[model samples]
Target: MSNPPVCRRCGEPVVASAEQYEVFERMHYVCFHYEFEHQGDPDVECPAGGCPAAGITLPSLLFRTEGLDLAQAGNTVVPAILALEKLGFAVEHHDDGFAATARGSRFVAEDPVALLGLIKLVETRRPWRATDAEIDDALGRYDL
Candidate 1:
């Protein structure tokens, strides 16, 4: 009818694309919007429309949840978000790291545990995840 839909992740319009999203769990086009719409994964930053990429590649999510100290979390958020973006996630670039829409957050909140969860999940895929330890430890690097 009026174009299938534009993918919010990437920055282009699309048609007939399978929108696969995984937040707390796997879901489809309709299920995703109605059910896990507002729920954002800790680190994952996938957009609502779609991954924006030709198709979804990374099929997982990893996150730390809300327990994270906002002030402390804010420090590691930027570099962490940047790392996720380099890995092909749709990051919204925030004052912290990235808020994540619905899709992107999925990958950041996958499984596994340790180091508040953020560094743990990402370490599974990207080595940069562990290196983030230095960043986290350097919280006093700047003033709140």
Candidate 2:
């Protein structure tokens, strides 16, 4: 069998249910939120027709979206961004879209029956969490 798909950013094989985000047709997730917020060109300043974003980089604007104190985090932010690209997800990060997968789409698409089953599966897994059993057990019950 072929190896599983890995995140373009993290270089790790996609874990089932770990969440994958899509961007430019690449499979990623950990940094999806931040990337989506900063999709605009970082070098372009916002037009000054009363636009509040007048001179900020797209990445900086993301910090304001959460009302977090950017000044405290600003200088240290670039390294974190690099690390997420190089190591893991950054603080305040988000994702743009779900990575494409045949089985995953089946769970997310608006099919009421499947959705309900998914909910039940998740509910069932919660109890298992307390018991130290495998979450995959719930999937086995579903014959998935």
Q: Please give the lDDT score at residue 51 for candidate 2.
A: 37
C-alpha lDDT score of every prediction, in listed order:
0.43, 0.41
Instruction: Give the lowest summed-lDDT range of ten residues in model 2.
Output: 97-106
Clashing pairs in 2: 21-28, 32-94, 32-95, 33-94, 33-95, 34-94, 83-87
For candidate 1, lDDT tens digit of each residue in 1-144?
455444455434443343443332343444445454634542344555443221223443322232444443346645655655555556453343333334434432321111224543454556544356666767757553
Model 1 deviation from the true structure expressed as Cα RMSD, one decimal place: 15.8
Deviation from native of the Cα of residue 91 in model 1, angstroms: 1.9
Which tens-of-lDDT digit does each residue in 5-116 have in candidate 2?
6666667776652434344234444334234433354344433332334334545355435565543234554443343333222223225311112323323323223333
lDDT against true structure, model 2? 0.41
- Model 1 misplacement above 4 A: 1-72, 93-105, 108-144
Off by over 4 Å in 2: 17-24, 38-144
Candidate 1 TM-score, C-alpha based: 0.21
